[model samples]
Target: MRKLQFIILLQFSILLFAQENEMKWQEKQYPDSLEAVNKAPENHIILFENENLRLLKIFVAAQKSEPIHSHRWPAVMWVYQPSDYEQVFYTENEKAERIPVQTVAMKKNELPMNVGFPVGKGDLGLSKNLGNQDLVAYRLDFKKKIDSSKKITKPTGWTWNEDLDGVKKAPASHQIVFEDEYTRILHVVLSKGEEESVHTHQNPCLFWVVKSQPIEYSEFKMDKKGKLRKSKTHQLPPLPTDQLLDQNKISDPEPPHSVKNLGTENFEAYRIEFKK
Candidate 1:
C-alpha cells in the first residue's frame, strides 16, 4: 500500500512539472499583428514583403532595449554587427527568464565573422543590447508554412566556388555560409573597385546588405559561343546601412549581371537563396 501511494505521489509531481512548463510556453503569446515591420518600425523595417517571404532590417542601438514583440513565422537571422544581447521570456505567473543568445564565429578572407541563428515563432520578449556597439541584422521571415517534403536530406557543406560571377573570384571572400533543405546562404565581400564576375541568379533570393555602400551594376548576355556581350550599365543607388533587397521570380529571371564596388569601403552582403 505504501509503495503504491509513493508511486502516485511521484506521478503527481511529474504532472505538475509538465503543466508548469506548458504554462510558461503559453504565457509567451504570439502577437496579433502579422507584420512586425509595420508594427515596430523603429527597430524593424520592412525591406520587402510578398506572399512567400518578408525581409526585415533590424537595428538596435547600444544599451537599449526593444519592446515586447512576437514573431509568428519561422525566420533566419543574419547578424551583421553582433554584440552582447539577451532575450527575455515571460511567463503567465509574471516570472521571467533570460536566454543568452550568441552568434557563431566564422572566417571570411581570414577575418573573423559572426552570424545569427534560426528562430521559431513565439513571443521573443525584449531584446536588450548589452554591448557598446549598435546591433544590426536582417531577418528573413517565411510567410508560408514550411513544407516538410522539400527538406534537405543530406548534411549541408560549405564550399568556395571561383566560377561564380557578379563578385570577385576570391575563394576566401566568397563562400557558402549556411544551407538547408529549403534555403542556401552565401556570403560575399568585395573590396573597392573590385568587380564580381558576371553571373545569374536562378532562385528567388533575399539580398542582405551587411555593410552597405555604392555599387556599379552592369547587365550582359552570353553568346552561343560562351562570349560575354555587354548590354546595359547603371549605378545602383546606395542602400541604407542595413537593408534587404528581395528578388522574386518575376523580378529575377536568371539574367546574367555583374557588380562592382563604387564605394571607398568594402562591400559585404549575404544572399539567401530559397528552394521554394
Candidate 2:
C-alpha cells in the first residue's frame, strides 16, 4: 500500500508540472502583457514602446520554438526573411492545436509577403520555426483599439488623384505591401547610388529600417520649364526614428521628396503612412 501511494503521488506531480508549463502565459491575468518578450530578449526585442504603439523585432532560429505568449493589440508584421512555421494556439480550457502558417509571395506592386492580423485581447499562441533559415520580422502593435466605422481623412492641400504627373509617380523601389482604411504600408528597396522618382507624401508617414544604411533625402522643386528638379539633399541617419509622424508634426504642405541610397549595400525599409 505504501509503494502504491508513492506511485500515485509521482504521477500527480508530473501532471501538475505539465499544467504549469502549458499555461504560463494565461496565469499572468493581464490582457496587455508582453511577459514572453520581457523574459526572452534575444528572440523578441522591443525597439520602441509608447502610448500609441509598440514596435518589436523578433527572430526565431531554425527548428526552434518560442514560448507561448499573448498579444492583446492589433498588429502589422513585416517579414524580412521567409520561413515555414507552425503556430499553436491555446484556449481558456487549456486545449491547444497547431496550424501551419505558410509564406506566400505577393506581386511586384502589391503588398509584401507578410501578415496583418487583429489579435483580440488575451489571444495566446506559440510559433515554431520549421525551415532551415531563421525567421526575422518586425511587429507594430497599435495600443488603442481601432474603430472601423470612422473614415480615414485625406491629407490637406492634396487631391486623391493617383495618376498625377510630376510628384505623384512612385519609384520602382516602392511596393504597396498592406493597406487599410487607416494606414498604408510600403516596402522600399533601393540599391547603392540608386534614386527614387520624385514623389509626394500628402499624409503623415514613418518608416522602419530593415537593412540599416545611409540615405539621402531630397525635395523636388519645379524648374522654370515646369519640370521637377532635385533640390539640396539632406542625409538621413542609418536608423529610423521610433516615433510616428502625423500631419500636424510633418513640415510643409504637399511635400514632394525622393530618396537616394548612399550606402554600399541595399537599403531596405517599410514605410507606414497614416491615412487619417
Best by TM-score: 1
The lDDT per prediction is: 0.62, 0.62
Model 2: per-residue Cα lDDT over 61-156, one tens digit each: 988988766665557666667577765655444343433222222222232255333333444567678777787877778888667776545545
RMSD of 1: 11.7
The residue ranges of model 1 lying beyond 4 angstroms of the native Cα positions read 1-40, 94-116, 148-173, 208-210, 236-250
User: In candidate 1, what are the lDDT values of residues 136-180, reduced to their tens digit?
Assistant: 777778789878677322223312133543233444456765567
Worst 10 residues of 2 by lDDT: 100-109
Q: What is the TM-score (0 to 1) of candidate 2? A: 0.66
Model 1: lDDT of residue 264? 94
lDDT of 1 at 266: 91
